[model samples]
Target chain A: MISFQHNRREFLKSSIGLAGLTLPTFLKARAESVGSRIPHKAKSCIIVYTWGGMSHYESFDPKPEAPADIRGPFGNIPTKTPGIRFCEYLPKLAHHSEQLAIVRSVHHKHGGHQQGMYINLTGKDPVGGIKAKSRKNWPSITSMISRFHNPTVGTPAAIRMPYSMYDNGTMMAGEGAGWLGSKYDPILLRTPAGKPYAGVNRYNDRELKLERNIEKRRVTDRLGLLDQLDNSLSHTINGSTPYERLDHYGQMAADMLLGSPVRRAYELEQEDPRIREMYGDHIGGQTLLLSRRLVEAGVPVVQALCSASDLAGGSGDNWDTHRDHFPKMKNRLLPVFDKSVSALLTDLEMRGMLEETLVVFLTDFGRTPKVNNNGGRDHHPGVYSLAFAGGGIQGGLTYGSSDRKGVEPGSEACSPADIHATVYNAMGIDHHTELYDQQGRPFQICDGEPLPII
Target chain B: MVGTFNVMEKLYYIFAIVLINSVHPLQAEPEALRDIERLNGIALKLPEGGWEVGFQLRGQKLNDEDMEAVVRLGSIVSLNLRDTQITSAGLAHLKKLSMLRRLHLERTKVDDAGIGHLTNLQKLEYLNLYGTKVSDEALEHLGQLHRLRKLYLWQTLVTQKGVNKLKNINPKLDISLGIDLTTIVVTNQKSEAKKKTEDLPQLEWLPEEGAKRPPDRSYTGSFIMVYFENNRSKPVKLYWINYNGEQTYYANIDAGQRREQTSYSRAVWLVTDLQEKRLGYFVTDQNTSRAKIPLE
Candidate 1:
């Protein structure tokens, strides 16, 4: 049987991690949504965010009958699922199709990179065509989950691997704890240690290391000094923004930094050699492995940026294939994605983590139907594909589809909000539950109705 | 009674004038009309920007010289030169068409040299080199076209390796690399790559340099970016040989400073100091926008 059994303390730790600080506030508001108290179907979630828009036509929704120009290059290949076809490049994913559910009709309105990313990551539209990211933007789905299920132990509630989504010199929106306090922000494992790309960020300077000459007595003295300083500040502050609350966050950060389990979770080198080989040495593969380790170590959420970092300078090769699309997908992009995703699914299933772990695959949006003059596709917000598996999600099924030319949604059109709702349902969080912002303004976590299939 | 009659007559004339003006709005010729007849190309001004130059019918009339003269007008959105008498020399004229979205060079003498001229056409979306002398080398020139969608290499000299190389640049690009169903080619199952210190050295981090950069921010040009990634522990002064073969002082890059800039294609980076003492040099190629100088 797929085990959903973890220690009760682990469960409580994840659900109400801010025991000494924010627990009272949660308890008072908990009665509004009794569903928040229910047992979660999934213990963890690994969201593989494929930034820069992976093409639907080339990956999940291959229309071979369409014109050569519309269909592009690759032909369709049979998956393990009956009557379902994927791109020829995704050979490994095709074999493991039985363990996956491909949703092919997730559509939205934002076409720009920042706008689409905002909607996809947060399930909320930008206040306007908000270009630069700000603190006013809606909190990411991971942040909302972190707020609901705060990790109790030294482990953080959520983490993001390698680096955050960046285009040119500007950082994209919706990859942070907007509206939510900075404490709920996902811990970013920027890069690994000496290896830089393979090992977890825990193997680097992120893990707390005392200076060579500084002894434990000096550290204790400094803490005492900090406490005295806090007492002095407390006299002046009259509001609830007290020194104790700041100390709570500081204490949590210190605990996380000094934690051994968190560091061990990021140590990919300690994993079995065969298992490491299963997930390729590529950045995406290693990051997914790290995500699995994190979830196993009691992290509720791990958002991974599935991309090849080597392509940053080479005409921006992170899935934004506006030209030479087929060559890139066939040779570099698709092969890495197919191998890594397949390995993750297989590894999770073998380890019996799939049943209690929701694996969500997402992208910015779909590409245009008509190929452009540069032999590539432009941004199209009409329709795209995303996927969810494990965590009570049925496998070997395609939820919805695009039109004949793979342009717009044909039937069962879904939005990013609906996908968010489905994910919350899988996690056993009430989709209709209301959460307050920094100013105490009430807002629904997800606006769209949850899919009946989940 | 005479005044009212005169006023009524004036109103009728005014109404007639308004009706005439609405029906017959004046039309101006397109911006390229002055030279369109000489080039035998149709020019239609877009409502937004640039001109759509169509040479579908009389493409054979335009030669290399005519192509040069016509492209000088600039702001061309689309250029259809199918079955034209133009050669590789004519492609140099298309370098200024930064707004070009569609280009058809089918059945022309355009080859790899001609395609090289189109590397700067960043907005070019549709490129048809069908029935031309284009080979594997033509794909090299197309690496910078991040917006390309439909490429027609049908009946050309492109191989599977060449097409795969181009696909690595932009995975979404739909190129016609003619995979015949009749031939069942078996690919070799190679062993996994041997474990190395670093498989992809281009992506490795260099020693951090402490050199400060001026905040002028006006230096902008389309060139291969050369990154002075000092993999060693020491500081190095960087120099580059320009097109004129003169070695000029670039910068004194500190060990902790990781500096990168768009530079010349065949630019040779000579690592030296203020005393003209030579350390080493890294020669950059056209294929990649980056070149790391890992001084030992």
Candidate 2:
């Protein structure tokens, strides 16, 4: 495990005196209240989902000895770990490798975009053939966790910020509560599409609040009347199945507008300007900042989708490098990922919250080991890399390995289920723990065995 | 008989004059002059037989194609292509302009590769590569420009080591490195200014006993930029934070000069005077990337 004491010592010895260091109010609050709740081993979980496939060859699993076309353009840089290295573009992250556990041999069978997303998000296969999002799909890991935890009043049990994932035009499956029902779904935290590099806006500004002149009592009376209407409609419609989502929405709206810690927690402007600057003003950076804020406010889980700055405006390429892959990855993708992700890790550690915050990085799948005719790697489900840190993780270690060419798992092969199981383990959930679905059918939360990460 | 003899003599003289005119060569202007003129560039014919080639003032239209014309000016003393589209490939044309004393490539695509083409400019006294892609590697090619007096590398990829190496070779060369930030305003003075907005009371305002509290801290993120503005009328040494969060010798901002650095976020800027005496340390806030520290 990486020791904070050693890091602190290194920091002081190598840096300036911490004179007049008035602690931030938010940090102080997070430190005191994050530990108040007692059920889970970790207080919060922040899963950085690289929605599209980030190339293994260009990132974690580099094959320097492979042919030029296979190896691609970038070279590898040494990390804090003695034997491991990351892509040259990730120099900042390389310094924090000692605090990370990279699993390079994780592989799954699905290669289609939505198929991979479904598998990774839910840690389970789709019930029927792969298709668009449906209520029949399993609840995502976040939604599953939300099912068990009672979130602090005014805050959500789990949250997915900025946006939900979509493939082409269809909303992908496995992002919500699924069969577990909409009540357990991870609520979407909305951020206005600002300039690509303006960082995040004040969190309170983004909160869903009551309209001007809307009295609290009047709102409550309206809710009562709506409930009465909904009751009659349920009878006429034969069940609440059709309006189950509406019921959840009403509850969420009431929770947000009535009184909640969410508005205060979203007040990012209260944060030190230097802190906002540090996280950067770009979409990826700001979203990560929002995630930190959400977790600090007692939200149990936050899934942040990492997209390119150009695409953060809601349209453009992701890590899905189909053409001009080298330039896109080097210029547009990796630089922002390196800065923001590394910033998140360092920020978490510095705040003394790393121990209680499980930081996980995963993607849909890995890219093909060989370069394509377009000088890009196509999708490959044979092998990929995933990483986890904090939440009692044993850092500075590789859990598995890819083959010499990074084409397949070579040893200690772990799948997405295993990775999710590891997260469940960190959150103090048993992988074998079974819960019933909406139809009263029993289902295990995860099937794969959790790796001995701690 | 005398009249006939005079007519034959006149005919012979006319024939001889025609032959002489045909034998003489065409005194055409140099090809370089024509090329420079095509781009509406101004070329002054120097008294020493050298040419001063430049675009009209505020006429930044000359590009790489016009640079090829420079190769014909064997005695070209100066060339200005500021804010032009000339790239590294265009630098090759300057290889034959060996007598060039001044070259301006400001805001161009001149990278490390292009710096090599100017190695033969031995008499080069002034070189401006501000806002280019020139890196530390290009410093090797510049070492031979011993007569270089002024070098502008603002917003470049050149590092301190490269700057030091070039300084060692050409001690007299004055280099203006780092971003030019005269426009950034210094508005916040925490000591004098009252809080504009009162912060809400937080649950975790104070730390409990013996819990290993992180040293009282402020700020967040990965990095921030600090600007040092010399408000004084004389050059003075200033100390600033580095990437590793260390306090070290930053730079000497000449009178009315400004320099900036991108350091790790939350670093304490320990500004020092010319004698290495401590100046007040200012915490880097987030509202602005340019932390203007006006040196009094």
Cα-lDDT of candidate 2? 0.65
- Best model number under TM-score: 1
Q: Given candidate 2, what's the lDDT at residue A126?
A: 62
**Location of the lowest summed lDDT over 10 successive residues in candidate 2 chain A:** A15-24
Q: Grade the docking of candidate 1.
A: incorrect
Give Cα distance to truth, residue A450, candidate 2, Å.
Answer: 0.3
lDDT of 2 by residue, B1-296 (tens): 45744564345334433432343222222344445544645454443445566652323576677676656757778777766778898898888888888787877788999899898888898788877999989989999888998787867888888999899998998776733334323344342222321221211111123243322333333333445555566676654444344455545667776554444445455545577655445555442244333435
What's the DockQ for every one of the candidates?
0.01, 0.01
Predictions in order: lDDT: 0.66, 0.65
Cα lDDT tens digits for candidate 1, A1-454: 0121122223223222222233221222222133354344565899998877889999999999888878976788999888999999899899877768888889989887788889999999878645433568788888777766654334577788767665655666787888886767777774242123311112222212222222455346545543453454333233333433443344343333343356666667787655666666667778888888887666789898886333232233367776546655765678778977887887666444576699999888988888764445888889998988787788888988898988889889999999999888888688888888889999888998777766
Please give the distance, in angstroms, between residue B146's alpha carbon in candidate 2 and its true position after superposition: 63
Predicted structure 1, TM vs. truth: 0.55
